[model samples]
Target chain A: MMVDQFVAQIRRLGHGVIDAVMRLGFAARFFMALILASGTGLRRFSLVVREIYFAGFMSLIIISVSGLFVGMVLGLQGYNTLQRFGSESALGVLVALSLLRELGPVVAALLFASRAGTAMTAEIGLMKSTEQLVAMDMMAVNPLARVIAPKFWAGVLSMPLLAAIFSAVGIFGGYLIGVRFIGVDAGTFWSQMQAQVSVRTDILYGVYKSFVFGVVVTAIALFEGFDAPATAEGVSRATTRTVVISSLAILVLDFVLTAFMLGGN
Target chain B: MERSTYDLWVGLFVVAGLVALLALAFKAGNLGASSIGSSYVVKANFDDVGGLKVRAPVKASGVVVGRVTSIRFDPVRYQAQVTMKIGDAYRFPRDTTASILTSGLLGDQYVGLDAGGDSVMLKNGDTIHLTQSAIVIEKLIGQFLFNKASGGGKSPSSSTAKAGGL
Candidate 1:
């Protein structure tokens, strides 16, 4: 009986892995369909514009405020460390590099996932539970093209822009702390940063990372919402899942992208 | 919001994002501003590059005049060959010495040009013959410890003196 139970547990674990793989496959197909349907959806440019405002504009305040705080903290920490070595002038380089290279994209993506991504998931999941999706299907309208495609594109386009704003605000915050407060030479702060950070290497790659993150986060949120069981509890669970899954995915993908983009450099 | 109002706001948002990106590229990344002015290329050979990287500033008298464009290994001499692009407005003497220098006790490395009293100015494709490699801290510390051990507990300054003599 013990031997049989052991076999049963092993079989259950195997089935669990297979189930996850199938779900992943389904998600991939769903994402591809959304992408293909987006061209048709693009004709309704108004819908996309509205979605962009909802996702991008709505998140600007949080992105800017968080960016400023993060940058100020970096400046404070960088100043304290560099002061010990009499290299306080390098504060600009420290702050700019930290923001452009790592913190900017990762932090902004996390914020986007939590704020915009969870909202998208909940909205779509509620629509599913309320049978609005069924109504659309019965009316012979493609829900993928009408509903998901615009949101998918909007999220994808907003990410890089949000990341840029974050980095820019963060730099300004650093300048305030490092130069205005700590008395590091203003010229040195700007010049050192200009000399060190590369447009292609640091900034563009960061934008690219955010772009990928945007697509991943939006896709996950939409997929979870679409797959959610048509119940109130299911919609709530899906919203929570969107946040948790997108956050984990962002961190994991950040590591992979960093290894590929920055390891050699 | 009305369609036109929404469009205007979205347009403003995109413009702001682009402006921020441009600021980052120009102010921080030093993008197209480099190529906007005329510049010339000069090469220098170093025994070691240490932490020197492409785009590291090439400074003269603590003022940036150019940037390191590329670095490659010279297999024949087993030295690192660094190519720099100096802006045309700030010409240096032909006999200028280029050295890899750290900005502080622990900081990024940059190419520092010490202009010599030569009458002729360096032009494009000119090679900087006098070049010093980066000072590796680990090698210096190892040398110091070796001297101290061999000197049988001598003062640190004395050990430095003996090491300098070696």
Candidate 2:
């Protein structure tokens, strides 16, 4: 009797978890479709550009510092091992691949989500609290256009550029740590990095992942913001939820994509 | 405030340009060396590969002169065999030592050659005779931790060194 009951409880718990995941996935898809299909939203071009600069440029310090440290760690650890086999010269190639394929986009996206996602959620939530969305609706203007599109485009535009900056600067960080500190041959390191690289597909994969992250992050922010009640407390709740959900969604999506791409891993 | 169509176009162009530039930079870096001097190809056998992968740089005396082209496990020998392509200019003496070496501490692994003293130079298809295996840092660290744990709180300088003491 006890074993049968335990099995039933476990099955119920598993079903509940699966149902929750499906609901989140369905919501994300619907939200993504809505944002993509809205055309006049793109007409708010200046707003998008400004938001891009604001979110990405303002957050450059955090990205650079993080890039520097990861690069340093890679260099330090890579140098010690390569020293044993006496192939320390190829540090640049290793560093470049690490930054380009993995670290750059993931870190940039996380940083961008923290900064921009929270802001978007708060702005939309505030509009809800003050009933400005209702006012815009009565004026025959789309609130989604006035609010969500700019945030969405900002996320999409900034992420790729931010990833690029992280990739470039990250190589320099590796160079400083690996070549200068660890006594790897700087010239050979650069030479290998230049010579042997994966195809355009590798970089394209990163950019595509950034685009996916943008959509996921913006959708979570918009949904949470729009769902918030017409109160200051509700706005705060929306802001918190948006940040948490967007960050989690970014990681979950990243894991899913990574598993799909690197199948059998 | 609405950005004009022209502004959007400019922004698009700038973004496209940056993307193109980054792609070109990476492309030129990767393809240039291979196109210039890809010549001799040879294979080396290893007991373990560690983190070595295809396209990793192969170096002689800390200078990159080649790259690993392929990796395959030899079922018969129960070992990983790495095939490498060296520049035409980099001819090794017959007694050269080839080792699977990593780039840096956290970097990827590559094949490294230590040129040896032999009168006859190695040819295009000759196999390198001597090979050192890959050294993984995590494994070494694990060994160290295990040694400290098991040595009854005594220093394991003697036993630890004998147990792949790297």
TM-score top scorer = 1
Candidate 1 local lDDT, A60-151, one digit each (tens): 99999999999999999999998887778789999999999889999999999999998999889989989998899899998999999999
On residues B54-97, what C-alpha lDDT tens digit does candidate 2 reach at each position?
87788887777887889999899898888988889878998999
Error of 1 at A100 (Å): 1.4
Q: What residue runs in model 2 are displaced by over 4 Å at the alpha carbon?
A: A1-33, B1-166
Cα RMSD for candidates in order: 3.9, 9.1
Candidate 2: residue A226 lDDT (0-100): 78
C-alpha-based local distance difference test score of model 2: 0.73
Tens digits of per-residue lDDT, candidate 2, A51-115, equal 66555556667766776788788788777876777667667777877777777778778777777
Kindly give the number of clashing pairs for every candidate.
0, 10
DockQ of each: 0.62, 0.13
**Each model's TM-score?**
0.89, 0.62
Interface RMSD of each: 1.3, 5.5
